[model samples]
Target: MTRTATSAHPLDVALELEPVGDGTVTGRTTAAYANMVGPFGGITAATMLSAALRHPERLGDPVSLTVNFAGPVADGPFTIDARPTRTNNSTQHWTIEMTQDGVVATTATAVFALRRDSWTSTEVAPPAAPGAESVEPTPGPEFIRWMSNYDMRFVDGGLTDIDGERGDSTTTLWIRDNPARALDFPGLTAMCDSFYPRVFLRRGQMCPAGTVSLTIYFHVDADTLSEQGDDAVLATARAQHFGRSYFDQSAELWGRGGALLATSHQVMYFKV
Candidate 1:
């Protein structure tokens, strides 16, 4: 169902898109999701996926996606072109580009597949954390507007005083929409990018940093997501290596009953 910007939550409004024909959709950036430089990266990625999910020929649920932030997105209107480049008996591939004023700002690719009931097993373990109720919610920094949209209670590696607190770069938290919306693919996609950049924890100070590329794989279907209702999802992330200009982060989201929802990895670049 298409969410009407007029009556839905701010997230729905930020994600709302208008059909402009030929697989293109136009949307505006709202302050609700604004970042220091532009709209938050997670919402940008979610919007791209939403376009393909709404496509007339979209085959099934999104199984995988890769979003590349090519340039900064200014605060205003943007256009996204989501094209299903290929489709098979059970899978479809899509290419999406978000442009502002005819200039490419972000690009993405998505894969959707018809899932079947088959033998499955989870090799990774869920994030070990006390119940969400046991942990105290951390207040988002006032300057970062987008952080206010999520209710986050940290188990460890929470956003710390940037600078001189060099320690482990792993973050475990329970997070959900501030207004408690049902968990879905778009929300799940956005959540995958919700972890603050690991570099901040490593150096103990914020810098000019941003995600360059993010890739996510969804492990559950619609029924499983619906079961989550508006409950917070357990999330954990850790960095592998930090180089001169970039670092790698791997993360996972777990639903109730210790069910894994998705796994994601991102490459972030930073400058001193």
Candidate 2:
């Protein structure tokens, strides 16, 4: 499914395309979504649950997802919705929504896994942050480009600098996604995942692999686009757990000025 911009400033969802369901979607709360001081935050859980609701079919997919917390999510009224945007013989796509106070807080499109049997492997070094000289921020119009909400500067020496040192498992960078985009919450949420891979390299290990899966949870429906001015957001992330072939990363979201905004997490499977 394609993404669009919406009016909601914080918990926004962009439904540029027509919404297929009139009322098939609703919002709910889990312990994780409850507002309490703990590892998991409600805003992130709510955002994630809302995203999952976008594609009910995924509930049946073999893929499993877990969302960790960087901070606490606000408690408020939130909305969730989804619709099929495209379908073909081989695969299907859908969009997700998280809304509150008549605004789209977060929106995302998920492509369901379809070809489990079709398998192939190739040699590839994991995508790593380029050296300080090479990792300059490429700002542009593409969604992947650094939007106006942030001012991201690679930490000196690169994430690999901490190799095997105490606190080496952590990766820090400069980020500021702020000012608030007036109507593009989903697009803002999408960017949250874009920088996730950087945290994995904090260990400074050679991760000559790819993300088998990725999931992002929004912690306050506070997805700002260009309208919010030049506000900034910072992300501090670390690997929470890892196995021989898989691992998870947790992140904290901070407004550019240093106020805590939200928390997030992702589960990754290294390509074997």
Best by lDDT: 1
Error of 2 at 156 (Å): 6.2
Q: Please write out the lDDT profile of model 1 over residues 219-262, one tens digit for every residue.
A: 98878788988888999999998888999999999998899999
Candidate 1: residue 268 lDDT (0-100): 92
List the candidates' TM-scores in order: 0.96, 0.42
Error of 2 at 185 (Å): 3.8
Clash pairs, model 1 backbone: 162-204, 163-204, 163-205
Candidate 1 regions exceeding 4 Å error are: 1-7, 161-163
Where is model 1 poorest over a 10-residue stretch in terms of lDDT? 1-10
Local distance difference test, each candidate: 0.90, 0.42
| Ten-residue region with minimum lDDT total, candidate 2 | 32-41
Highest TM-score against the true fold, candidate: 1
For model 2, residues 93-195, the per-residue Cα lDDT tens digits are 5565555565654554554434444443423222233332334543423332223333455543243353543444555454433324432234334444445
